[model samples]
Target: MAFTLNVNGTDMEVDAAPETPLLWALRDHLRLTGTKFGCGIAQCGACTVDIDGVATRSCQFPVEAAEGVKITTIEGLGAEGEHVLQKVWTEMNVPQCGYCQSGMVMAAAALLKDIPEPSDADIDLYVDNICRCGTYPRVRQAIHRAAELLKA
Candidate 1:
């Protein structure tokens, strides 16, 4: 099947099966590899992306389901590397192996977009993505830092 995907403010037409996961289309067809593939199942957030401004697990989301929806990957999140969350992530050193940072960043970006000043509990409850390097503390700190940066 062929579907048009609005990715990072660009319209891209890709030929793929209806059941093909959005992750594959983005990585394979669109050549957008920023969205990682940690777990094929949706349990892990490594394949997280923004669909209509909502953080979604792309691994389980069918490609056809994303048709006509605006999708944003880590590559498109920041402009000139100035996104508050990206700046904070860099300042806080949020990645260890760097495998899960994309998804973590995506989830954090969504959380901060909705709640500019999120509490620790809010982060805990909302950012459920896993980081194997035990970088949760840093991730939490980065979220707060990004929030502060946004406020400034």
Candidate 2:
């Protein structure tokens, strides 16, 4: 099936099966590789993307369901080194292997949008993405720092 997806503020056409996961469509068809494929079951959060402002697991989200929704991958977050989260992630050294950072950033972006000043508990509750390097503390710190930067 040919699906038209609004990705990163651009309308992209991809030919994929209706049940094909949006992760593959974005990476294979649209060539938006920022959204990674961690766990195909949507448990890892490595394929997180923003669909209409909500952080969604793209690995299991069907491409047919993604049509007409505004999708934002890590590539769409901002220009290189411009997004507050990106800067904070770098400044705070948020990633160890960097494999899960994109999804973590996407999840964090959604949380910050909904809660500008997130508490530790809120961070724990919201950004559920897993990092094998156990960078949760730094991720939280970077999120707080990003919030501060956004506030300034």
Candidate 3:
């Protein structure tokens, strides 16, 4: 089936099966590889993307369901790391291995949207993306820094 997905403010057409995961379509078809594939079951947030302004796991999201929804990948999150989260992530050096940074950023972005001034507990409750390099502390700091940057 051919599906038209609104990605990064642009409408692109792609051919995929009804149950094809959105992650494959974005990476294989749209050629947007910023969204990584960690765990296919959505346990890991490596394939996280912004769907309709919410952080969503793309690994399990069917391509057909993604049609007509606004999907934003890390590449679309900012123009060359201009987004607050991106800037903070870079400045704070959030990632140790960096494989999960994109997904972490997406999750953080959504958390900030919902809770502009999130507490430490809020950070723990949300932003549950796994990091194999044990960068949780840095991730939390980066999110806090990003929130401060947003205020400034």
Candidate 4:
């Protein structure tokens, strides 16, 4: 079947089964490689994306469910790569191996949207994506830094 998804505010048609994971449609068909695949199951959170501004796991989500839905990947997180969170992430050195950074950033972006000034507790509750490189400390730091950047 052909699923037309509104990704990053662009409409693109992809041919895939309804059961095909949204991750595959985004990466394989749409060639949006920023969304990574860790474990096929949703536990790893490496295939995170924003569905209507909410951080969603693309690996477990079906392509059909994404039809006409607004989606955003790490590549489109910032227009022209100027997102303050990305800058904060780089300044804080949040990534070790860089494999899970995209997902972490995506989740953090959603969190910041909901809570402009997130507390440690808010981060602890919302930013639950696993980072195998153990960059939680830096991730937390970058989140706070991003919040600070927004305040300025």
The pairs that clash in candidate 2 are: none
RMSD of 2: 0.7
- The worst-scoring run of ten residues by lDDT in candidate 1 lies at 78-87
Residue pairs with backbone overlap in model 1: none
Clashing pairs in 3: none
Residue-by-residue lDDT tens digits, candidate 2, 31-99? 888889998999999999999999999999999999999999999997586899999999888899999
lDDT of each: 0.91, 0.93, 0.92, 0.90
**In model 2, which regions exceed 4 Å deviation?**
none
State the RMSD for candidate 3.
0.8
Task: List candidate 1 segments past 4 Å from native.
Answer: none
Residue ranges of candidate 3 with Cα displaced over 4 Å: none
Residue 113, model 3, lDDT: 93
Candidate 2 lDDT score relative to the true structure: 0.93
What tens digits encode model 4's per-residue C-alpha lDDT throughout 1-152? Answer: 99889998899999999999999999999899999999989987899999998999999999999986799999899855578888888777788999988888999999999999999999988888888889898999999989988988
* lDDT tens per residue, model 3, 83-126: 99999888888888899999999999999999999999999877
lDDT of 1 by residue, 11-129 (tens): 99999999999999999999999999988999789999999988999999999999979999998997465778888888778888989988988998889888989999989977899
- The C-alpha TM-scores of every prediction are 0.97, 0.98, 0.97, 0.96
Candidate 4 lDDT score relative to the true structure: 0.90
Error of 3 at 37 (Å): 0.5
